[model samples]
Target: MSGDARGLWVTFEGGDGSGKTTQAELLRAWCEDEGHRVVRTREPGGTDVGQTIRELVLHHRGDIGPRAEALLFAADRSHHVAALVAPALARGEVVIQDRYLDSSVAYQGAARSLGAEEVRELSLWATGGALPDVTVLLDLDPVAARARLDADDKPFDRLEAEKSDFHARVRDAYLALADADPERFLVLDATASAEDLAARIRERVAPLL
Candidate 1:
């Protein structure tokens, strides 16, 4: 890792069942094996306060407006950064987060009909303008992604139960984010096998490694 950059912050993002967690773990292991200090965490719950917000955001059955959800995610993100992210980065560790600000932009902003640019601005404010060094977005077909979720044993959360069209919009938003930031966004095709997906991510991380 470059000393000047301090630490490399990487985030994995995607819709439900997009294999982000598995891939994040794989990358973390790889980074550690290469002797880089690593800190693995997740958004919506990287800290105690964030986890509380996660439960409400993920499972709450009552109606929540787009702006409200976006702010909640931002609140969780702010706590996550204060409690974990910034300190890890200052120490020069490789910090891999399962999800992050991009999730709010895609799900709440694009999927829920809020504007994408506004969501990005909110994310900047929430995180104190800190952005990931790189973001890996698992680009999966909405139908296949939903099917994978159905096969999982975990109960579906409110967001998971959303209609296909909603998820499709979210997926589009993710792609748009990648397109807007080619230097730091890696779009992995979700159709790839796990092994292939990992390899693709390795390729993307090679420069930083």
Candidate 2:
């Protein structure tokens, strides 16, 4: 690990059932094995306050206005960065996160028909412009992702329950984000074997450590 005062921040982004959690855990274990302190967390529920917001946004029975949903996610990001992420990095601990502003931009901005730039700006403002050192994007077809979700036999969350078209738009938005920031993004095929994906992610993150 580098003896630098600041630590690395790594985030994973993808649609439902894209295997982001699996990759994140693999990276976490790898970092720990390298003798680096690691902090594994996720947006919308990384902190105690964020847990309440996560439930309301992800599991609420009724509909939530698109703008309201964006705001709620931003609020969670604000608190999560302040109370958890930033502090972890300051302590020189690697932060492995499940999602970040990219999800808000993809889900609430482009997919919901709101302006992508607008939602991105709101998230940047909320987090005081925090960004991950590396972002691994598991690109997968919406239909395939849906099939995987269905196989789990678990109830879908509000976002996961969205129509196919919605998920397609989210996928496009994520790709666009990656295109705009190629340096920070490692876009990989979600259909690849878990070990292969983990190896690629490790390759990208090893230089930072």
Task: Score every model by TM-score.
Answer: 0.95, 0.97
Candidate 2 lDDT, 103-145, residue by residue in tens:
9999999999889999999999998788889999999999999
TM-score of 2: 0.97
Q: What is the number of residue pairs that collide in model 1?
A: 0
Q: Candidate 1 — worst ten consecutive residues by lDDT sum?
A: 1-10
Q: Write the per-residue lDDT of candidate 1 for residues 1-209, one digit (tens) a residue.
A: 22445888899999999999999999998999899999999988889998899899888878877788899999998888878988998888889999888898899889998888898899888777888888999999999998898788678997898999999999999999899898889998888998999998888886875
Q: Report, for every candidate in turn, its global Cα lDDT versus the true structure.
A: 0.88, 0.94
Q: Which candidate leads in lDDT?
A: 2
Off by over 4 Å in 2: 1-5
